[model samples]
Target: MGYSPTHFKSINPYNEEIVCEVPMHTKEEARQIVQNSQEAYINEWINTNYEQRAKLLNAVAKEMKDNLDYYALPMTEEMGKPINEARGEVNKAAWAAEHYASFAEEYLKTEYIESDATESYVQYLPLGVTLGVLPWNAPFWLAFRYLAPALMSGNTCIMKHDSHTPLCALRIVEAFTKVGFPTNVVQNLMVGHSLLEDVIRHEYVMGVSLTGSSKAGAAVGAIAGSEIKPVVLELGGSDPAIILADTQDLEKAADVVVLSRYINAGQSCIAAKRIIVEEPIYEKFIDLLKERFEKLKLGDPKDESTTIGPIARRELVEEMHEQVDKSVAAGARLVLGGQRLDDMQGFFFPVTILADVEPGMVVSCQETFGPIASIIKVKDEEEAIKIANATDYGLGGSVWTGDVEKGKKLASRIVTGQVSINGIVKSDPRLPSGGVKKSGLGKELGPHGIKMFVNTQQVWVGPVKS
Candidate 1:
């Protein structure tokens, strides 16, 4: 099913239906949009003080909250996130706007530094336009992750959202316009991957922020590197959830693992793709996972009762099956699910669990982007830590244990950007989130995030004094 190069077709994953086709912007059109964005930044938005930006951002928050379903249903129809989760995502985006609206001033305030000069300080100033290349999953949340801070910092934005989610992207831009943001302050550039280099290399785009696969990140990073423009990448992840033997509450631990791994049909970049269990409780944990996997309801994402939804694309369904087949052939035992439900329509895959999975297997080393959990049994904490850090990607993970201090220490040893000691790993507006290693570069969603698209200039005043 190939689509026209000049247009993007939004196909619903729940039923394999084509929702709409949005025409891709031509190179010249893209240039004009970027030009307008730059003009807006240099002429109006840059002069708009933080108080004005804050008021507008708060208005956006209220607009989203007032019409939550209006912005959320498109996400469900387009990307197949469950209806309830889709609503929550809108809320998360709104919360992020409120967060930056409240905190951007403090985060970007000039800092006085102790130096030999009479007066020295550092200031954060906006860089003209930032080009955000976002992914299909969590479209609203990811876009706002870059937008809230980038806009609050007095920069205009040009969003290059994934082709699979054009409607969501349009809605996002619509949200900004409804709040009376100046024209072109935030414009959605509907273009294919082939034209991305041109967009990044555009003179108006001073920085780039991307959230996608490692391969995509590498390609974009290379182009941005050549252009010498700042870029922030939030890439792929194969996160692990470690269950130490000393855990007093195995049931709660099991719940956390299942929820983290299965939410959004396990399409999340930070989902618990691997579950590392201490050997003593391996059997019990496997049993818990099997029972929970059986109970999860998979159906229309528009259904309120549905717990899991369809994979965003049919290609993802086949890719996940390939991973499962290879892992099983490599000696990973299939415990609960091992195949897609053929009778079901619209790219449905059950919650699959593989037990006795060892390191170096396809499932262990590769980033599994669907709802298939690989269970690895480790003899001790040392092995668990080793296995957790074994992957090429390190974004986020969780460690469950009764001993808080020991859990914190174990979390420190893991080579990831963030970890939660007895909770599910999630991205919050108040905290920073990103990855290390192949997971990508830079951070998002916190004090550091606002600075990613800004110029950190240092000022010093010196006078000769005897």
Candidate 2:
């Protein structure tokens, strides 16, 4: 444990309650664990077969499902994610584990080609122990994301999760052990920010991947880069969601926008922070989205009836409130929600709507990172295109329209890592997920996600004599 007479306290963000005492990991402990992992990888795990590892993955998924009730409560209690969402996040982690299990053998198969001098082929090899620096927004999913791809690729992982969701972080370690994974492979370090550099700089650490703020991502990438190690970072996104005038359903568009904007209490990096609508249906879209925002149920995360929960930390909630306050002061209208939920603790705020948000307005320019929505109107498809591409972000974007061809065309034109034509941005086992511009380096969570951790080597031999 980290806290002492001299250390810090971890609190429940929902009720202003002191949740637990956190541990500050001394550099020695971090180094020892990293050394242990390095030793473990060399002595016991480096040559582990995919089939055996695959079984463990399947078991991990099953264990998560069987223990869903066990996992959901801590997520709600520690992180204040609504019970439904907390459960959903847990389930997705399980799904990612099993998804990799199902295809890892096939995915890792070596490629062989005929040659005269000898045989030529390529095989996936483990990259030793990986360091996963994850955010609290989707604690379990982020940890499992790195573990799933790393373990299946024959690598071990060490997870350094966000401070706010510490309990969920430990449970991730438990999940693997419960599913029969060896000790120390999926290690969870309960440490302070002061110790981050210690973990990243450890001699045994081979690579790093993080999903968090740009500052943190950049810092970690620098350290890993200086060591000549690769880092895959899924940083913040001011992702755009565009609704076309020609789209068939206005109400449906509004519904999807609300959910996308506020999922995880509006904490998702990829959640559609910018809603750019085509002029013809813009009025209707705004009206419905504004109205719908009023009806969302908020409160106890354990209450399955609740749709939104408190923001994860007091400081984050305060910062988000300030962002909204600035937006409204600078001329954005507070259409739906604009202040704290009068009776809650930690940090609870109203679901806000801001209109008349110009390019530099607080809501328009910044990643609000909360349950606030900003509706930007566009006179035509061309204008919508311009507004969506205005930001430096190119992680994800969505284009909605009844014309599938037009949707596809718009999707192609958007300079992002991925675009969902009529749905939400998602990390799938089949498709590559990540971003193009400032979103960070490379992709994760599919074959691409798995490949990022392995060294792809080609064996070349002279072609057969003709």
Candidate 3:
């Protein structure tokens, strides 16, 4: 491959070896892609009926399922997610594609309004090319979450995936092409962050959907807003897992809490970052969590036995360590595994746990995107709720309790995009997921997701006189 100054080199987080390099598209090439997507939207995609779109979407899903093993490799290599978890991410993406394909028609059906003079109704119409700015963590799942819904709504897309995972990003575009999507229908632009503003402000691009840091969101949102274009942002999250006083299943709760926190090495936006346990069961939960943390094996992501893997990059590992250090200095007790594994070749950090974690500490207030569990002791359910909602983020939170009704009540009180009762907060194809406050702007998934880039046009008939 030809090397350019703008080419992105993918590095394996497991071994710190160079995987491959992908050349960045020039400004002219990026403009052409956007224009081509707009043409596709106007000429063919928008005119196609829901049945035709659904057929193609389902075909894409089938292709993904057939090549699950093939696709999971790149994801695991580039991002250090466990091989099994990478495969699971592919499966979830395929499921999302099929889910949107099966339900888009019903979700977008015209709504009839009764009137005295004449008939009136509302119909969902397709917008033009949408710009998807996706992140590297769970690369396939995050892109598909927006791609499936955007395509199902008859809108074409131009994706600007994370710079670190160019190979995985290209494979995503290839999947659509392999499934018989026309050229430019779902294009991936291998470009740098400098070009993001130009793409978002392009005349042909109608909307923007992003999943990234709050800083990135603010930059993109500003451009989209200036152009009077709609933008959906899924930004940073410091999610909390509340363990109530009456939670009877401490073992089960501990298991879920550990899995939710350390899965994807805690890089996920919705990972359980803060563990808030009531005073009565606080010590019990902490002991159980400590045991669970001790059992995690940090090694090669490709190893099926490895529960914790390296962070996606060295910079992230450094940042996580800094947070841990500052939090420790601020009086958070380092219960276990607070040091980085300097002997390891790759970006491996220990499954660290900080006890007596309280407000004002770095781990408690900031979004730490690594396998560091910060446990906070709460006086009661009210304090748990208060602590959970203390952060500026309101992405996803959960309540653990044996009483389902009580859990639901507490979940409702927490100000977040989505909450779980007796379970972990996760993105589902059947449910709407997004956030409020600084967390994000709009929703994704469910019927609401498919409509994010569409226009709700009202059709009115002429009055008929008697």
Candidate 4:
């Protein structure tokens, strides 16, 4: 392959080796992609009945399931997600496909509205062509979460996946082709951020769906907005996991927090970054978390015995360590690990936990996209709620309490898009997942997600008699 300054190089995060280098799409190539998707949608895909769409989607799901190892192994190699978790992500993406196949017809059916006209109703229609700008953390899962809905709803898509995980992106297109999807119905535009504006501004492109950092979101959002098109952004998050001093268990609560904070080596956008505890049980809960952190095995992601793996990039390692040092300088105590595992081959950072962390500390306020958890002590439930909402992000968070009603009420008070009570925060294909404030602008799953790139057209046949 010819090397260009703008090409994407797939690097294995585990050993910091270049797996492959793929050149990005040129401006002309990107324009052709949009044109092909638009033509496919208007001439073939749009006329396809819901049953046919469902059937094809189901077949794609099966293809992915049958070739699980093919997709899962490369994902682990490229991004350093644990082998088991990588497998789980592939299955979860398959589940999303099956889910949309089972529910798309019902979700997009015509809705009748009572009015003076002879008949008034609303129907959801395809927007022809849409763009998906996804990240590397959960490549397969994020792609399907956006693709399943858009495709099932009759809209063709062009996916601009992260350059760090090009193999995962190419495999997604290959799966659709294996299942007999029409050409260009779901294409991967292998391009870097430099060409994003030209893709979004393409005349044939209708809408945009992005899952990336807040800075990337703002840039994409502005470009899409200038063209007067709809854009859905699932951006960065510093979600809080709040634990109350209730009458029930603390160990279970600690388990949930640890899993949320450390899963994917703390690379998930929705992963819990801030840990808020009621002062009465603050030190005890911190001890429980540190013990669990010490137990996590930090090694090769391909090893079945390893739990936590390396960060996706070497630059991220330095960036995260800087955050930790700044937080410690600002009065937060580094209880456990606070440095990189240099003895390891690749980009590995040990599970770091900080205590006595105030609300405005560097680690507490900024989005730490790695395995560093900031522990904050709040006096009571009121103070806990205050600390949780102090950050600008409104993505996903969790609350722990004995009383279900109290937990639900507390969950409502947290200024985020979705909150869990006595459980870990996660994105489900069955629920609408998004954020508010700086977290993001639109939802990406469930019934709400499918509608993000569609045109809700109103139909009325009327004869007014005065």
Best by lDDT: 1
Q: Which candidate is the best by TM-score?
A: 1
- The sequence of per-residue lDDT tens digits that candidate 2 reaches over residues 21-82 is 56756778878889878887998788788888889888988888898978877778877889
Mark the 10 consecutive residues where model 1 has the least summed lDDT: 1-10
Q: Per-residue CA lDDT of candidate 4, range 99-139, in tens?
A: 99999989999999978778889999989899999999999
Ranking under TM-score, best-scoring first?
1, 4, 3, 2
The residue ranges of model 4 lying beyond 4 angstroms of the native Cα positions read 1-4
Clash number by candidate, in order: 0, 9, 0, 0
lDDT, candidate 3, 11-96, per-residue tens: 89878788878888899998999989988888888888888988988988888889887888888899898998998999999999
Candidate 4 structure lDDT: 0.90
Name the better of 1 and 4 by TM-score. Answer: 1
Which pairs in model 3 have colliding backbones? none
Identify the superior model by TM-score, candidate 1 or candidate 3. Answer: 1
lDDT of each: 0.92, 0.81, 0.90, 0.90
